[model samples]
Target: MDHKALSAHQAMLGTEVSRRRLLQLAALSVAGTALTGAPAHAAPPADKHTYRLTVLGTTDTHGNVFNWDYFKDAEYTDSANNDIGLAKISTLVAAMREERGAENCLLLDAGDTIQGTPLSYYYAKIDPITGGHVHPMAAAMNAIGYDAAAMGNHEFNYGLDVLDTFDRQLNFPLLCANAVDWHTDEPVYQPYSLHTVNPEGGRKITVGVLGLVTPGVAIWDKAVVDGKVRFPGIVEQAKVFVPQMRAAGADIVIVSCHSGPNTSSSYGDALPYPENASTLLAEEVPGIDAILVGHAHLEIPQRFVTNKQTGKQVLLSEPLRWGMRLTVMDLDLVKVRGRWQVAAMGAHLLNANTVPEDPAIAAILTGDHATVRRYVNSVIGTSAAAMSAATARYEDTAAMDFVNHVQSAEVARALAGTPEAALPILSISAPFNKDATVPAGAVTVRDVAGMYIFDNTLLGIVLTGEQVRAYLEFSARYFKQVTGAGPFAPADVTNAVTDTAPNGTPDYNYDTMAGYTERLTYDIDIAHPVGARIKNLRYGDDLIDPAQRFVIAINNYRQSGGGNFPGVTTAPVVYNAQREIRQLIIDWVSEQGQIDPSSFSTTDWKLTANDVPVVIQA
Candidate 1:
């Protein structure tokens, strides 16, 4: 789910159903077929016939094999002081399996196995797994014994060839039921995986795991997935597969979905399905005992929803992203006649901070980690003055201007001889990282990579001045309405929580525009409502004309509808070379050999409230 669209979905369950009430229904959900041939009023089963199964799950582990921050060149830390990495999770999994008995335990990951850290990026682009080099994520997961994983949207970032190579290297199956071939509508990867667990002195239990990914992938990765694959809604595909799993003799069915439990989408009405639909999947589809939710990056210990048709409760759990936590689900089964039926289910999260990194996982990934570290630390160029994005979200800073500069330069160079080159060029950028900085003396690959964290590619879209104003108005929703401006902290004015963003809008959703060869200026007036926030919109010295035409250098995520920004998705694409934006910035600096802020930095925008400049306290 996009950070800006994490709002609670009220329409799916109607006004009468409270989210708390729905989550309280987490007890037991047995398949009606599993209790066949048993009397309706039969006596309770004896203790001897009961069996227990434990499932350990993780999600959105975005390529952190160790608890290190490649950008900072140190151990990763946050305000919460949580530890991250698969190494720490591996220790927790080992301890759980040992205590619960290895045979009764299964380990699974919900998705996003690759593509966040420098290590994952190195394998995907620099060293490339397609060249016979094993992906470090695959090697680490295999060593830690992951039974299966679903496909995350980021898995398609480097294209299908790299994704397929990583899949082949993994010892376990990479499953995604909804991701189907565009031509044949057949599954592009395994739909589900069946595991037969044999308990001590008990009948064998068949566990069926169905995997589904967010349909927003169609919009987010349109460049790579356009004619190759299509994604159906989570509930749409679950309704079809749950019955098949039951008919195939699965005593228990679990869904590992790379979708959130919320029922909202960032892409507005562009797609027919909601981007986050795990809760809907449970309520609409029957026979699912539990679900492992992903993609929202939320820490949901446990949530329960009642199936509308069966009146059975389905348990759902999601560990926070980046290996910060683990979800443990325990299911108890009681035998009726000679078959096992789900008696009860429970789930909770375990903090990875409490455990130490497993030495074995470190041993397997140390070489790869070291190589990435060296590559990121190598000096690229020198900066004449330090530039920081610490205040970029609330104020215009040179760090973000540097990003816009590189992007606009690349897009302009690509359109040099084309007919579109005659038009004015503008660029859009977001404050992806508040801590990103470039030192005054020297800049390394890590410094540049930190400024532009996402692996988004670049594209040029033509937009009229009216559409550009609409786009800025949409981005202005990131701020709360302030009547009179006094000195306020940065957080006091930004990341407004509204009906659309229950958790508050993230910094990445707030974009600022810069001109390539001309000056584009505007003021975001917080005294006015959202749609009317952009004030004093001007291009150079004249007011922007509504019918004026210009080309904007934008990232693929935005052009493909990532933030649901206005007009960009349907805008005419004049240039798309599939070039990664971060790499472009790095190459720009390397080629220039120096970063001088005076050449590119300009303050073209500011915040105001009723004609008074909004003052932000340090």
Candidate 2:
């Protein structure tokens, strides 16, 4: 192929992807484009002069198969309603391979693939009939054809035993050099895997895939897996392993990580979205042609600026959580001086709607869905109406109130048989996506299946009344008070502070959201804690005092300083068991079976505009 032909093909690749994805693809050392299903054309044999490669990947798929949130069932049906699942994604992947021989394309995953939906939850929990069987996510992924994948911290939430079983059942390598087996003194994970490609002129290239999990898993999963498993730092591990993989006879290197770079709060207080160490590694480590990132669930369609270390550009991609979109990165790697370098990296969002579902994948997901319903549908409790757990108005609306109340009720009951049980209890909630509209009446299993959708478990923490106020004061981070009368200006959840260490990204400014983005702000007013914006102070039915010894109901993350919630993190954690809030909701619902919205009510948190500027509608 001549220069004109190559340039034409490269341009075609650009139009094939979104403008944002095109920018990420242009950063690649090589170039190529991809189509779905079967191909109308195929490249010539090994003797051809031109070479092409396609890289397909997805990140932050929080186990959403049916499109509807299992908890909400048919009730919740906004954009977050139904979306991507393995079947649709498999169809897309298969089509891409058909468009370009499967041999020329590499199928990979970033992380956070587990621990979001009821299926993942059911897997985390025991299979009621199977004695103790893990979920079928790994099996489905294998059936769908994932060549290699890195470890997302959510995978560790199930413990290494479950992970071991998952590793055994998988045909592809579950690579994660950073996660180690201290007991065996081994790396503990499959470090890397090789993918052979068939390009034009019948040329062949070996794509080296390396996997890395975020090191912060240590703190995030403290209750069940703190000391059992250890993780190597990402930047350090990449510095050592990337070169070794090349020596192992690989043509190109692709970094597969379950982590990504720092991002500001999309809608909550300083959520402190912990990364998997992919961004820092990209800038610090060389030889990595492209990167697949996850965790924090933000999509980077264009080239993200790496740190000052390695200045070379690296293509980065992370589609929105759930099977909402399949992030496709078409990497064109051609031989340069007898070696393969990144020719092009194109990223695009494959709408699940546009693609046909694969039968095998559909069967697996459908079976899992049935399994999920069998357990999830067992009515737990009655709600007065359909309630959601999504956070809203920078505060725990009805949903937060429900989960926190259930936890509080559970903790109170557990503590009822103990001494000093009169202490007031406080629970933690993120106020995330809480604005979900749940009409009054009967509540289904799907509505409560994954109330939080995260692996955060309930904890019983002891705290003083003074510390309690400090904790409440910490939530002031979400306040964006008004200078004058207008509307409630909420906090800037998307503020990527330039002060963050390493690379400071100022590219993302101006709130991209259109409306309902209140600019309400405020100061902590630390001198006063209780009786401030947050109320309903109590230990069971009794009121709370600044000196009372209270057993607070909280999540493991807040118990470990996650929200920087004053005394909550520093408080003594009395109990830490289970894997997800859904399990608790499941138990709560199962004990009741049929739920009405009345069973779930709003907590003490609500919006107030006293002693501040006018509510401005900017």
The number of clashing residue pairs in each candidate reads 0, 78
| Cα lDDT of model 2 by residue, 1-618, tens digit | 011222112112112444334223322312223322222123422444445566778776766555445655542255643356765566666666666576767888877666676677677666521234434566567666678877787777766676667676666788888777657545777888877775655457788999887766766676656666666677777888889988987888888887766532222233333344566677778778778777756656535444465666676777655665666666655577777765545565665554445555555456667766776555444565555533344333456566666677677777766663665565555544443444454444555644555667778878776666556554543444333333443433212233231232221111010001111112222123223543444444445466866566777765655533456555676656653565686677667655554444433434344433233231
Ten residues in sequence with the least summed lDDT for candidate 1: 26-35
Task: Give the Cα lDDT of each candidate.
Answer: 0.85, 0.58
Q: Which ten residues in a row have the lowest lDDT in candidate 2?
A: 511-520
Off by over 4 Å in 1: 1-48
Q: Could you report the Cα RMSD, in angstroms, for every candidate shown?
A: 9.1, 9.2
Top-lDDT candidate index: 1
Q: What ranges in model 2 sit over 4 Å off?
A: 1-50, 75-77, 80-82, 126-134, 183-185, 198-204, 263-276, 304-311, 384-399, 416-422, 432-442, 484-486, 489-547, 589-603, 610-618
Best TM-score goes to which candidate? 1
lDDT of 1 by residue, 1-618 (tens): 021121121012222433233222211111111222233213323455887777889999998889999999999899987889998777777666655666888888899888898999999999998998888888778777788888888898899999999899888889999999999988899998988888767778899899999999999899999999999888999888889988998889989999988877777778999888999999999999999999999988778799999998898989889998888787778778987777777777777776667777776677888899999999999999999999999899999899999999999999999999999999999999999999998999999999999999999999999999999999999998888886888888999975556677788889999998998999999989989999899999999999999999999999999878989988999999999999999999999999999999999999999978999997
